[model samples]
Target chain A: MNRVCIVGVGSPSGDDQAGWLTVDALLDLGIRSGDGVVIEKLDRPGSALIPLLRSTAWLIVVDAMQGEGEAGQIQRFDETGWPHYGHGLSSHGLGVIDALMLAGELGSLPPRLDLYGIEIAGTTPGSSPGRAIRAAATRLAAMISDQLASGFSIPPGTQPGYG
Target chain B: MTESLRSVSIHVPVLARVEGEGALDLRIDNGEIAELRLRIFEPPRFFEKFLEGHLYSEIPDMVARICGICPVAYQATAAQALEKLFGVELDPWARDMRRVFYCGEWIQSHSLHIHLLAAPDFFGCSNAIELARIAPEEVRRGLRIQALGNELMDLFGARSVHPVGVRIGGFHAAPALSRIKEMRDKLRAALPEAEALVRWAARIPVPQDDQGFVSVAMRHPDGYAIEQGRIGVSDGARIEAEAFDDHFAEHHEPFSTALFCTYHKRPYLVGPLARLNLNHAQLPEAIKALLAETGLELPSRNLFHSLAARAVEILLALHEALRLLENYRPPDSPWVPVTPRAGVAIGCTEAPRGLLWHRYEMDDDGRVVSARIVPPTSQNQGRIEEDLRLSLLNFGLDQPDDALRLHCEKVIRNYDPCISCATHFLRMRVART
Candidate 1:
C-alpha cells in the first residue's frame, strides 16, 4: 500500500507556526521516513507539492491562516473546489487561483486533497502562535491520524488518487 | 493520393531568452496542439537534498549557484535568516550595502530581461544579436547599465556572481568611504546610459496595461525598501514578513513541476509588476518624472508593461545606488557573531524577481537540518503558465510556426522564469500502435 502524506506548512520564525506546530504530532504518528505515512513540512506551498502529491494517496495540508472568522480557530476543507488560498504567511509572491483552475482545465491535478487551516496573529517568532493555532494544529493532526487509521474514508463522489 | 506530415517535433538543448535548460515537446496531434510540455531537465543540483548536512555558514555561497541572475537575493535571504537565528542585528550601514548589491542585480537582471530576453518580440527578430544589427546604440546603453550594475555589486559584494562579502551577520569587509565615492563616478556615468535604456524601453510596442496583476513588493513608509521591507501587495494587502506564511499557501498539481502559490486564493503577480504596483510611490523624483515624461502609471495590470516597469526599477535602483554609495561608511566591526540556537529562522527578502523566502533548520551544532528556499520563479510558475495560455489565446494564432513560436517565447519571457531553480521536469513516451 502506498503511504499517506501529511505536510505541515509554516515559517519557523512566524508566530503562526500552528501549521508546523502540529508537525511533531504528525511525526509521532508512527510515520517512518519514506514510509507509507510520509510526514513533511514546507516554508511555502510552491511547486514542491508536485512530487509529494504524486507519491501519496492522500495529502493533508496544515498551515496558519488569517482569521477563522474569529481568533483561536481552525478551518478544514477538502480541496475539491477552487484551490484553497490563504494570506498573511511568509509568501509575498503571486496568487495562482485562476492559474490552478486553468491547470485543472489542462487535466493536471492531484485526486485527493484535504487542508487544515488555523488562524494566527503575528508571524514573528519572538511572539507565540496564539493558543488558537497551536491547539488547532494538534487537534487537526490527531483527527487526520484517526481518519488514516480508519482507512481514510472517501467522502462521496470524489475521484480516486494514487496513494 | 495526398498525405500530410501533420506536425514537426522540436527541441532545445538549452532554452535561451528564458532561464534554465529544457527541451520543447511540441507534439501536434493531427494539427491540434496535442501535448505542449516545457520540460526542465536541469538535473536538480539537489540543493535541498544535499544541503542537509552542511553548516549554515556554507549555505549562502553554495545555494547562490542555483541561478546566476539572483545570487545576491539568495545570499541576502540566507544571510538574513542566519542572522535572525543567531540573534544578530545589522546596522543601517550593512543594510545599505546589501541594497547596493541588490541594485546591481536588479539592473543586470532586469536589463537582461528587457533587452536580450524579452526585447526581440517587440521588434521582429530571432534574438538580440539580430536586433543589434538594427539598433546598436540602444543595445549599447543597455549593456552599459548592465555593466555598471555588476561593477557596483563587485565593488560592494566582491563579485556580481555568487558574492563573497555576504556572510552570516554582515559583510566580510566594509567599503571604504573613498571607494564608495569612486562608485559615484561610475553610477553618474551610467545615469545617462540608464536613462537611454529607459527611453528605449518606453519605445517598445507592448500594450500599456494588463488586466489583473498582483505585484508583491516591500512597502516602507520612508521610501522604497530595496533589500529590507515588510510584505506589501498590489491589492492593498500589507502584512509584516512575520505574517507571510499565514497569508500564503501552496498546493501541488500534476501538470507543473513548480508549485502554484495563491494569495487569498486568487492569481496575483510578483516580480517587476508587483514591485512597481506596490512601491511606485517610493520611486525617486527623477524616475517618477521619467514615468511622467514617458506617460506610464503605476498599478498597471498589463504584463507587457512589465518591460517598462523593469526599466523604471533600474532607474530607481541607479538613483538609490548612487545615494547609498554617497552615504557609504565602513563599520568598526564588519560582522557580528551568530551562535546556533537549535531552532529555526525564517527570512523573506525581495529577489529581483519577487519575494524570496527561506526557512532554515539547524541542530545544536548549527548544521542545516533542512532547508526550504522558495525562489520567485516557483511562486510565479503558475502565473507563467496562466499568462502563456492567455498569450496563446490573445494572439489567436493563425501565423506560421516561426511567428507563433516567437509569440510564445515572448509570453514566457514576461515572467522571466528562472527555470533552473524551479523543480526541473521529465519526458514521457507514449506508445501508439
Candidate 2:
C-alpha cells in the first residue's frame, strides 16, 4: 500500500486543470506509484474523496483556488485552516471542502492531510492553463517532492527547485 | 387592521443542501399568496444546441456531461434512442450490462440524496455534519453504500463521474470476468445494509401533509423500470417516448429559466416516490415484503415519503445488480455494429430523479440535426411550485419568516431537484400581509 497519496482535483477547463497538471509534473519528476507515493487526478470527485483519503497515512490535495493574491501564487493549508477558507455551497454537490468536512465528521480523514492551492484567475472551459499557472504547477511539484524527501516536515516558503 | 391589509415579501438569496443554484420569491397580500416563483437563475447551458451536427457516436459522451450525479441516465437514453433509429439490436450481454450500469446510478444517486441531501430535514439538523454527530453509524453506513454504488459504475463505465464507457450500440468495451465477480461480491454484501437503510428511512417522522397528485414514471414489462420503459402515469395512461410531447408540455415562466412541465395542464409528481407508486407491483418479492414491513402504502400521497422511496430503490438496485452479475460472462463483443438512417430518434429512461425524455432528428450520415432533451428536474418544476403553494399554506403561512423559509427549502429539496440540470434552485423571499 502507498504511504503517501497525492490527489489532484480539477477538471479539464483552463486553470481548473492546475491540480492535474501539477500531478503530471510530479510524474515527469519520477514520482512513480510504487515509490511509496500514489498519484491520481480526479475531476471533481466530490464525496468520493473520502475513500481515497482513508487509503493512505498522508494525503496531499492540490487544486486551483481563488485567493487574494496574484495568479499562480501557491499556498498551503492544513485541516485547522480549512474552515477559514470559506467553503461555499457547491452547485455540483459536495465540493472539495464539503467532502473534507464530511470526511472529518465520519472520522475518515487521513492522519496527515495537506491542501495546496494554486491561485488562478479564472477557469475558462476548453482552454489550457496560462504560462504563469504552468510555471507555478512545476514549482509546486518540486516543493511537494522536497516535502516528501524531508520526511513530510518541510516548512512553507522553502524555495522550489524551479524558479 | 392596517397590518392585515399590508403586503409582505420574503426572499432567500440561495438554497442549501440541494444540487445547483436557485432561489424562491413569495409575495403575500391580504393573508393570501399573491405571487410565488421558484426562480432558476443558473445561466442557460444550451446542451441541445451543442449536440447539433455532432455524430451519433458522440452523443453518449456529450449528454453524460449534463449531470455529474446521473450521467448514466443521459448516456443510456441517448444510446437507446440512436440505436432505435439505426435499428441495431443489442447483444443480450450488453442489454444485461446496461441495466446493471443504470442500477449503479440509481444506487449512488438515491443513497447520496437520502443520507446527505434530504435526511437532515427530517432530523431537524442543518446539514449532514450535524446529523452525523447524532447518527454517526448511520452516516458511515450511508457513505459505505454510496461508495459501493460508485464502484459498480466504475466496473463498466471506467469511472463514475461522467463515465466514458457507454457507446451507441453498447459499452465501449466489456469488463473482464474477474472485475464482474469482484463487483458481484460487493453487491451481495451490501444487500443487508441497503435493506437496513429502507427500514431506517421508513421510521423517520415525516410531516403528515398528504395531498393528491399524479405520479409519473417509466413502466417495464419484465421488472422495475430503470433503463427502458414506456411513460407510465398514475392515471392509468401509458405512452411511448415519442408521444411524450403530445401529453406533457414544457413552458417557461418569466421568473425562472427552467421550463415547467404539466400533464394535461396540471402539475404531477415524478422521481422516486412516483416510480414506486407506479411500479411497486413489478418489484422483487423480497423488496415488496420489506416495503410491507415498513407499513408505507403504495400510491403514497405524502411528498416526504420520497426519502423512504429512495431508500427502497437503493435496495432494489443492489438486488437487481447482483442478480444480473451472478452469472456474468465476458461477451465476444460488448457492442454491435451500427448502421445509421435519417430519421427521428426518441428514448426515455427512469433516471434516479424521474423519467428523462430525449428526441433527436438524425441525418443520413448519422449526425444530429436537432435535439430536445427534457430532464426530470424541469418536469418537476411546476410540481415543485405547486407543492410549495400548498405545503406553505398547510404549514401555516403565519409562521415566522425563518420557519417559513426553511419549510419551503425542505419541500423543494424533497424533490431532489437537480437545479443545475433544470437551469435551477432556491434563494427564497417571502412577502406577506
Best by DockQ: 2
lDDT of 1 by residue, B288-342 (tens): 8888888777677678888888888888888888887785668887777777777
Write model 2 residue lDDT over B1-433, tens digit each, in one string.
5544456687776655345667888887777888788888777899999999999999999999998899999999999999999999999999999999999999988888888888987888877777888888888889889999998888889999889999999899999998888888889889999999999999999988878899999998998989988999999999988999889999988788788889999998889999999999988999999999999999899898999999999999999999998888899889999999999999999999998999999999999999999999999998898999989888976777777777887898899888732111234454443
In candidate 1, residue B145 scores what lDDT?
Answer: 71
Best by TM-score: 2
Candidate 2 local lDDT, residue B101: 95
What's the residue-level lDDT of B257 in candidate 1? 53
TM-score of chain A of each: 0.75, 0.86
Interface RMSD of 1: 17.6
Each prediction's DockQ against the real complex: 0.01, 0.32
Give the distance in Å from residue A21's predicted Cα in candidate 1 to where it truly belongs: 53
